[model samples]
Target: MSTGKFIVIEGMEGAGKSSAIAVIESILNKQGIAYINTREPGGTPLAEALRDMVKSVEHQEKLTVETELLLMYASRSQLLANKILPALAAGKWVIGDRHDLSSRAYQGGGRGFEQSIMDTISDITLKGFRPDITLYLDIDPHIGLSRAKARGNLDRIELEQMDFFIRVHNKYRELAAQDKAIITIDAAQTMVQVHQDIEKVVIEFIAATDLD
Candidate 1:
């Protein structure tokens, strides 16, 4: 059997990543694909603890950008080592709700960390694991924040101001521009339309890769 595909959905807060993941899971189920749906910063027990530290609204000790970056990677390392790679080796598609892009966008762009620093952490922590395809849901920061607010219970990252999110969005665009493996989708469209677009992309990617 072929190696499993690693697909990730990424975006700023409240860009409907969770919804998109659900849609993707449904499609994968319909296709009888063995897949694992997971999220970064919390995929493993240790990683989940790290996620709480990173996202706790009350942990307002003002972490340095580099420190934040390191914590993110720490969680990622645990997740990849304990959950992601094993599933992939077992021929299960790993659909991640978020991935390394979140680090590049949030810590690198939003926090104004150097690209070299971000790259170093990613390289060291991930070794060579890269997503087969990354689906970026593009939405206006303001709109996304509004959606997030409607959902209530803002985490530390979600509580960040609009300016921070603008930076994050810009970084996402930059990363998408630089990488052929990343696909950006207009997320302002209705949920049905967004799901249709995502489905089309998944079909094309699977066909191009010749995955069973």
Candidate 2:
């Protein structure tokens, strides 16, 4: 049987990833595709635990940047090994809420980690696996943070200062431009318009994948 395709939704907080995923799910349902959805740093049991540790604002001691990066990859390894690979092998498409691209943007770009270090860690964790397509919802850091704050409590990362998020935003844009598999969507638009743009890209991807 052919391996199932992997599609990922990527963006900084408040970029409307949940809404975009809903649109993809609707399209996949209409196409009668069998699929599963997963999220980064929290997909499986161990990963979920790690996710909590990383996100919990209650940590009396700050989580070091290096520890945070490793924790992210550790969770990814579990999810990939115990869930994602098996699902794809079973020919079930996977809709991912976030993936390695998050690391590339957040840790590599936002944290200012060297590309070589990022490359080394990525190779160790992912080997060569990657999503077939990633829809990146792009928005200004100021705007995105406002939206996130309005939704209520922010995570440890979300609680980061505005300047930190600005760095993340720049990294996201930089990496998205260089990668063909990554499709950028202007998320500052009205929800109606953002959803429309996402729907159009997903439909096109589905059509192309079906042909392939």
Candidate 3:
């Protein structure tokens, strides 16, 4: 049996990942493809719990950098083993809200962890497994944060200062540049245009590959 593809949508807070996912889903539906949607630091029950622990502002004690980084990987491990791998084995495409890239950008860049640390942990957890494609919605942090603020109360990560997001934004671009599997989309455009760019990418991928 053929294995299904994995598509990851990555970006800073309010970089229009949700909108991009919607566009991808629409394209998949039109093509009659099967896929399961997931979110990083989330997806499985255990992962969701980890997500809450990491993101919930209700926590009295602040988690250290190492602790937070490990938790993020822990959540990712659960999602991969319990959801992603199984779905792919069954020939179902996986559409993810965020994935391993988030850690590299957020913890490695935003938190200023060493690249070696990030690579070591990622290798341990993922063992070289990666998304077939990563759609990175490139957007200015100021703009993205403004949009995020309009949504509601910000999560712990979302509440980070401007410089933190700038680092994340830069790291995302740096990684995307090195990885050919990643596709960058101009997310600063109107939501309609963002969706169109996402659809164009998805359509091209579907047309070029015969996963079925």
Q: Give the lowest summed-lDDT range of ten residues in model 3.
A: 203-212
Candidate 2 all-Cα RMSD: 1.1
Estimated TM-score for each candidate: 0.96, 0.97, 0.98
For each candidate, the alpha-carbon lDDT, in order, equals: 0.89, 0.92, 0.93
TM-score preference between candidates 2 and 3, better one: 3
The candidate 2 region of ten consecutive residues with least summed lDDT is: 203-212
What candidate 2 gets wrong by more than 4 Å, as runs, is none
Which sequence of candidate numbers ranks them by TM-score, best first?
A: 3, 2, 1
User: Ranking under lDDT, best-scoring first?
Assistant: 3, 2, 1
